[model samples]
Target: MSLLVCESFLSIQGESSFAGRPCAFVRLTGCNLRCRWCDTTYAQEGGGTARSLDDVVAEVRASGLRLAEITGGEPLLQAETPELAARLAGLGLTVLVETNGSLDISVLPPEAVAIVDMKGPSSGEAERMDLANLARLRARDEVKFVLAGRADYQHMRELLPRIDTARNTVNVSPLFGALAPAELAAWMLADRLDARLNLQLHKLIWPPDARGV
Candidate 1:
């Protein structure tokens, strides 16, 4: 099956533990949710190149990168994403799928590390997270929360007791320009929250508005 791919390129990873590493990315098109703070709104539209699964995998292979990511407009929105993920992993690349926690992630290959972004209070889509997927989270998976304010941080505090933070990497980041990382860090220290502070390294290196970074 062919996938509607928004963009694909090899660039330095700007987020997660793999930040600063060169990675190939396949940005698929389409999304079901409209998160207010979405950065890749351009991906939500229908205009994109239609690439077959094999073709997409070929691109990654040609890049000669050890790391590759399938991002979105919610990559899982397309039925072929799991197959694309498996093929990428089959090539010995460390496959990462940057996903919103609203779809069924079990479809992805076990070799791919799933970075599930769990919506926080200010995203307006917090309730849309699929609890079933959250329950299936393994230690290999990562969960992220982009906090927008003190209210979001408080909500995260309430959510911590329900999660197995020791088994997985819990990532928290400020909502880009809405809040400061230092504020979130201070709150984490005061509450003794077990989480790693996440920053958009790509945004720091390039203008936040830059594309294909």
Candidate 2:
């Protein structure tokens, strides 16, 4: 089957526990929700280029990186995503699938780590998030919260108890240029929150607007 692919490239993983690692990225197109601070607005529409699953896998293999991430507009929006994840895993690569926490992550292969972006109140799409996915998280899976301000941070704090951090990794990411990292860090430290402070390393390494990093 063919997938609607936006662009594929090699870069350092900028989020999750795998951050700072060399990785290949397969960015699919078309997101179901539109967050106010969404960075990849370009990938949300236009139905991107269609590529066969095998072709996509070959690109990652040729990258020579052992890490691969299937991200999107919303990767789960495509039907063949699980098969693609399975194929990449079959290649002996550590595959990570980043989803916008609106769909059932159970559809992803067990070999693929699921990085579920849990929308906060500031995103305006928080209501679209499927709380059920929190219970569905696998040990290798991760949950991320991108906060735009204190309201978002508060919202994330309310949901933390529902997630089992001992089993899954929880990431608290401040929306680039929207929230101060130090302020968020102070809040987390004061609360003794059991989550990692994840920053978009690519944006720091390069221009925030630069694509194909």
Number of the top TM-score candidate:
2
**Per-residue C-alpha lDDT of model 1 across residues 1-213, encoded as one tens digit per residue:** 899999998789987878889999999999988999999999987899999998998889998889999999999999999899888888888888999999988988888899988888788988998867767776688888888999888877777766788887888888889998888888889988889898888888888988899
- In candidate 2, the residue pairs with backbone N, CA or C atoms under 3 Å apart (3 or more residues apart, or in different chains) clash, namely none
lDDT tens string, model 2, 1-213?
A: 999999999999999999999999999999999999998999998958999998999889998999999998999999999999999999999999999999999999899999999999888999999999999999899999999999998899899989999989999898999999999999999999999999989999999999998
The TM-score that candidate 1 achieves is 0.96
Q: What does the lDDT read for residue 86 in candidate 1?
A: 89
RMSD in Å for model 1: 1.1
TM-score per candidate, in order? Answer: 0.96, 0.99
Best by lDDT: 2
